[model samples]
Target: MGAPLSAWPWENLGIFKYMLYGPFVGRVMYEIFYEEEKDWKFSWCLQLLILSAVRGLVYLFWNCYTNSLFLTRNRQILKQGVDFKQIDKEWDWDNFLILQTIFASMAYYMFPFLQNLPTWNSKGVIAALIFHVGISEPLYYWVHKKFHGDYLFTNYHSLHHSSPVPQSLTAGHGTVLEHMFLSLVIGIPILGASLMGYGSISMIYGYILIFDFLRSLGHCNVEFIPHNLFETFPFMRYIMYTPTYHTLHHTEKDCNFCLFMPLFDALGNTLSSKSWELHKSYSAGNDSRVPEFVFLAHIVDITSAMHGQCCLRTFASLPFRTRFFLIPFFPFAVIGVSAMWLWSKTFLFSFYYLRDRLHQTWVVPRCGFMYFLPFATEGINKHIEQAILTADKIGVKVISLAALNKNESLNGGGKLFVDKHPNLRVRVVHGNTLTAAVILDEIPKDATEVFLTGATSKLGRAIALYLCQKKVKVLMLTLSTERFEKVQKEAPLEYQSYLVQVTKYQAAQHCKTWIVGKWITPREQNWAPRGTHFHQFVVPPIFAFRRDCTYGDLAAMRLPKDVEGLGCCEYTMDRGVVHACHAGGIVHMLEGWTHHEVGAIDVDRIDVVWKAAMKHDLRPLSSGSTIKAN
Candidate 1:
């Protein structure tokens, strides 16, 4: 009977009320000290410090909570897969705390110098905020530009740039000099306003809280700003900055230098080129429940001899449509070919689920072989389109065109696919970039001359151009002299001296390094010299047996490891290698790069592939002395 059930002990003591109105505790203390006739300046100073400390504590807790919420809420869009509980070794929290304390003390020391104590009223508070923002933007921009100078950047500013993936806590994580500069940038505006008699103690504390919140928001990895808000009010984008804008400053390093507002960046022309597109695309909160998955689609022709023969024998009794329907039931037929009638068709063969440790997700690579031959351009195009449609049904993120697929779909280097298949979310890549990279990297440094077959083809043309740039003597072999001369005329003026167009295979024998650009028959392999290093770039790789001869493939050299189903010629040194085109799809999946990487290879992309391979500890499978087909 001491207390009713509705009136709890904690409520009767007013603990809940005190907690709810904790910020007003400073006001209560100020009033109590005023009654005692304490020194007004000392009492005001104590109240200001208390209020500032309370706001700072509240912001810190709010930052932690909001960051956790955003990370959990938009896990898929952020896609960092980082554990917030695990502190990074690079974060110097001890130094951060010490520097913050020093800045706080400095701000407190400077407080007495200001003539006007800040007014606690709403109008004064609003006026002070406007002044603070107006002054801080330009001051921060110039100081930031100075910090980016060579001397300061190398010694101090580079510490902040170390975080490629930033978080809320990283907002102030930098060297002592950097932190001092940043604190000055935040502090000067408030001090200037107070000196002008526009700011009050409450205004100073309020501005600091808002400043910290905005800075924290900029550093947060999650893009929380609604894109439609900017669309509705275009000027709002100038007034506010998104997380992507700040992230671009870290990744690109040359743009988006403003602190809170993008006004300075727009004036300086320092905004990122892709900032608006990224903001619009990524700002919509992501589905957190969707588990990350990568898909790779490959094509294998059903017209190939090994698979075609088996397919014909198996489907001898079945009708055309019957064979098509039964194709999925027969695993061997699916892997190889269906029938001669369906040779113009493409079918998805094998599917792989590999754990990509880098992305912390499952990467699925599917092999879909087209039934059309290399030279069958019209038929190959029809099958390629069908293969893409089938891949779309499976919901593959990316489909890599291999060999003949590349040859048919080389219109603007797969840009045609992108234009034609807008509804299909799957991205098409030629996978030729890394193929060229592997070929270039493997060529013997001292070799003066290299033989390039099918020089008019896209891959061959790219290689020919790259080799010409390197000043290596290139023997360009093509079936048609007209096509050869056309390519020669198109070659750069400087490259003319190094390039030699040849019609015969005998001309290639003189060159020690042979690049097989087209599918070589058994007779064609014997044309190269005994000691020649044949770098095969074609699928279903062809090999020559000669005394002390070396055989390697462009695809084999770039593979992180020897995959079981990869097409390798019957040779010891280059066994267990997959097609370069197939490897390209796997590379895209493992790295989780969702873009069109088509046409001529980018040399930079090879470095990316090499780094990913090393990070994942991927290695070539054991190569036996004798080759065995999978």
Candidate 2:
């Protein structure tokens, strides 16, 4: 924009291109006169032409209004960190022109472009609308199928989804060749029907306008469909739409096609059967692989929490020996739970809160007015609980410790303070007040297990160094694979290195993780055991074992695959629990957890806890594995 308008590409051609569409449409209208009604004089034809032009112009203006903020994003804001890459491609006006010409031609000549027959009768208008759907929809559906086949999607349909955040104006702003091809794909059927005295051309105009309006509405960021409509008239769901449904299409979810009706999509197998309930996940690691077996993992981030399908599939697939059916049926095992809960309360008075239905509290959140209510509540609270547990174990005053400055770190007297177990009796200080001596304050008096978020700040680095010098157990938390690499690269190189480093060393080590972005602790791990939402509140389990945890050992692993042991990662730490991204958390369990760490994890100066056994350590409660407090 700093350059003069003369340097701008295509600034001159825009006016010329705009003028070209007028004559092109005009010629098409002139041919339509042959099908004009006898009652419709030249004056009427002129009126129709003017009306169409006005309607098209009005539609275009509406898109302009909605996108008034479009030009603002063009300005650079400071320096760019990560370019979203939505606008990197070069634009070619000529290619767009060619496409427009093709779509317009197919829409006009190949399809029945005139519907003057409807000007004479009332039913003619209604019949014309029905006839348009009967013809074009089927034809478009089949052709669209071709565009989605293997090897075709990346080169073809991908261009349209480049803008994941499609604004209202982005409607139909794709290659014109696509438009022309579709026109022939659609219009020819109408043309054939019209020649057979079965179709009216005016319907074609109505269909295009309706398609554009509804499609644009679907692309809007706001939710137009009232919740009451979806809940009350379930049958009418396919009638109107909610924003969540359409916006997901602009993302990497490849298989969702069909704009007008879901019929083609349903038959095409492109519709995500999991869309309804796929958003209730609470993972701490980055290995979200979207498991093919359950497909439930995909929903964890969405709302796909339903376990019904898994149960059915497991029941059908598992043999008696493998106990695969036991996998999915776990969610439903709570059947006799209430009865036992009542008995325990009435007689033994154990698990009293659970047995007494009136006082029973659920760790899992329940639904309220909105659908995602329970999920949102649980997700928020679960993270917070982890934060609190981590803080408590780190040995700090739960009340005094607060979140740290994102750009900096916090320390507590020669030891990085954490609010892990909640029994601390100390005051928290501002980041500016922190120093190396303040960090090493009081060596936990005489505590055992040490914990640390390794990638904290310089203050954290000082505290960690002091702790290491003292020979206290050092628990390091490393986050974000990219930053992990920066430190890892500068780290004493273990040569045998070539591209980045030129030498070799016999004894060297580097950080095990490689996540993206900064390692966040407080905001991510809600220090509170539970978080409250506008409608509901939630409390998540903190023990390594979970109650009602559907995936057994997977309950501890983030984005865990199935119960199957996929073998060890580079961390040399393979447990059903410690995947590479989350191995830092296993520091607390290091006391007796060596057996579970399948990979050759560096166990130096570590003491992993050992428990989960059928004999003594771990016992099964209805909820999950449990080890009683000493």
Candidate 3:
């Protein structure tokens, strides 16, 4: 059986028509406009410079106007005004123009490289252009991919990626090496056509103008292409690249490598998953508001098929010395085992778009089973870094680390991430402020005494101090008596008497309200009194509690009926509670503040953040519905 006609290379016909006819039109227009010019060299140089400047200025104006309109349409208020500091840092117009002039002057000197053909013919020009495209596609793909590597990216390509919401002027705002590489890529095609003795001076100049225009359009940050054009003539998509296509390449460096055409990208299997949908939405002129912030959480599952549970179980069974010996091999083993399950496994990172009436957010989940394993610190940290990098690539303004991710990253709150990835322009937040607010809201108004487990831990200590400051007696319980005593002493002299330090679980019976600050096993849950109201902070709450006990994960608590949950965490508890950390970050983003509220949760700021969160009508997930960590 043969393939259908639709499967054939009919798309190439569009490329042929544009390449052949475009240059022919340019030739006729040039002769009519510049027939009197005797010095071909000087005339060509002047024409190239004028065209480049005019195209750059026009696109620059268009980019600025559209971006301003987009902000107004989406109701995005820039709290800090325009990020001129960032623009100044990323854009070196003086240096860029200098390099451009040098490149143009050099090209003027190398005019001999362009072989003047004896006659202009449609068939010859088309054949030459086809050959030029075919040769340039693969070369550009590999070089472009090379720029994505760590060394090259940091040293050269990072400048290009600096403009997340890219303007047309950003097209030429790259490092010397980056611009040099681009020059070669653009020149190779024209040089090839010239060397083939098939294109005239006018034809060559026409090709340059077209290339420059397309390059500017690709970086314009506005989608002007018609959506239905691709649907009506499906083959055109493969032949012509749209603005959305190149924007994705800038945001997501892993895909869409082809410059002028998507042929290489399709063949290389590097197209982004959201590319087509983004194209459709942008092309349709839909109000596709870009994400201002993203929240990152790992899906916590001990028994899921893709979580490497079997390996975790085996690792748990190994002796201490054997486990230590196998530690180095764990990553390699994981890679080998994961390859077999790759087809069935969900991606390591997945994106979800969420919005409420007042706000919009992006939630990204990192997939892994080792998050629960105490010894898998390195593995967990690596995954968190990956999620951060991914969020940065997508131009997320702020990223909040959820649950276990906060713990592994030094609960430095989010400072560790900021320090580690200094180059990642996005801000890192632990979302702990909102978590603290939610937990505080749940505390019984009449209860003067409260039992706080993991009192020496970060969140536990913070909550204990908060309770003591409010004149509610806090029964601080922890395995470390020394740490417990230290925390008690650190309290203000006036509030010290309200801090009750306990080193034993049995002492928790003295308090009616129990707050579990850390992840507890079933055995640990038994220590709580029979009818205590338990506010749990950890995820997948310890469910096997006494029948009389009322339990809820305080951090995941949702707001009242009037408030809407903005899809922070994936799961909901008994009432419509969301993860407090996720909600806190959302509140911050909504307020347009870039504060990193991880370990530094303040008692005074809780009410402010809480009121803002309540405005959105944030609710908890329905009971029994499974949500992955946001």
Candidate 4:
């Protein structure tokens, strides 16, 4: 169904809709700049904006808190995770607050009674509560029941119901008309008290804060309220609704439409018979689902750190790009980094399902630059070790180390952990075997000679050995001839001649097939022939500087279509695709391999892992295609 006429005019503006507050902001600015004395109305407007900001932070805190696996374990009401559709649908959850601000501004101009309100009125609190309980509750109940009727249900109410598994934002998600009704239901209590000379700034703030608190509590999808509380004081159930109570309204629809009170639903005979039972079940902490697979990841940079699913769902769903709005938060990000460095440990990042198995991603609180800092290696390894131990204790089947977490220098690509805990049942995987495989699969089969950069590195060494065995001449690029000879000797004597050491880019000027395992400058890239394709396995992938040559993405694979609940992208990869190492870990889990894939890449298992990946329908994204960079 199309959006109703009551939809917000600036709904399509997305995050930029906050700019609507500009005029109110300008009013306060003008009063401060030009006038020695400010109008009370203008000052109140500023207070409203500040209050809205604080309320927004409250919602954000709840969102992150509920999503924290450790804190909310077994307390989650819905098993299903939010998808990109729900994220986009609820992106403008603060629109209602903005609308309320606009309404308050209009009412001040229209009614002279609202001016010069006192800072606090104890009687106003009593009046506001009475008005809310006696008037707003019943009015909202009837309006909600009516909206479920044929015309309104189809055209308006369905948008809110679209999210069966709700978050805090879901409480504010509805049609503009729906919010208009909500504003009146909520506003009348405050305004009525004001007109009767019982309204105060404290009363307004307290009433709205409680209103939002209850609304968010009902929609957060976490069963934090203890069942014993309701059992002890049975009357409290009629007074307040739990998250489980409101979830039934979305899932079971037709029943439990009351706002904040089950008493309304009880009176209307619309309350679900199972509401109490479900609440008890959720509050008892019985539905914990531990993931079988976890991909251990670390932040690549300051900008990449903000691309977390919890930080910004909309931004994380797409390939990452630097947004102008993010610039304002750079100082806060620096503080967060400092905090993480000092006190943070491994935490759950995101999760999804594939073939009835739970797959999670965990993050180590360190940036890419931190990995290179000599002093930070011990700290980073400690976080990783703790994560592995925790996963093992929880009976996790597999945990894959991503990117710099598996650095050869740090822990010999995770060999340190596995060796340190030899009795550990949980399989640790570097997933680099499949990374080498994906990069190798991208090279043309007919090409006899290939120029290799970073030839002495792990994947590079494996690649040189594997290619030489196939009779492909590998011009190994390295300054250290000793390192080149060391990797070359790994191949059979017959293939050793095929792996030749070369120190400079000029050695590959005639070579058309280039396998890049290191970051190369525009000048280094120019050495390859005009028609050459660059296959890479480097971090932050090499820049595509030459328009004449086609550049390949870092090794990655499209996950099988059977996957579900995947809302956010993995760094810069597309929606359903993930880094080859991430996919490799998935394959490791799906194949039920008992071995730990650590240390150097296994040259023999390259084909085996590649074939297993293919068997599971994880297609290589870089194969048979060329990416031309401008």
Clash numbers, per candidate = 15, 62, 15, 0
- lDDT per residue as tens, model 3, 284-307: 664544456666655443122222
Best by lDDT: 4
lDDT of 1 by residue, 15-92 (tens): 243343343455557666666764454444455446555644543554444433313345213444322122342333
- Which parts of model 4 are misplaced by more than 4 Å? 1-6, 40-42, 335-344, 625-630
User: Where does candidate 3 stray beyond 4 Å?
Assistant: 1-289, 302-368, 372-376, 408-411, 421-425, 519-530, 557-569, 572-577, 619-630
The stretch of ten residues in a row with the least summed lDDT in candidate 4 is 621-630
TM-scores for the candidates = 0.40, 0.34, 0.45, 0.94
Worst-scoring 10-residue span by lDDT in model 2 = 346-355
Question: CA RMSD for every model?
Answer: 23.3, 22.8, 21.8, 3.0
Cα lDDT of all candidates, in order?
Answer: 0.57, 0.33, 0.59, 0.86
lDDT of 1: 0.57
Any idea what lDDT model 3 has? Answer: 0.59
The number of clashing residue pairs in model 1 is 15
Worst 10 residues of 1 by lDDT: 357-366
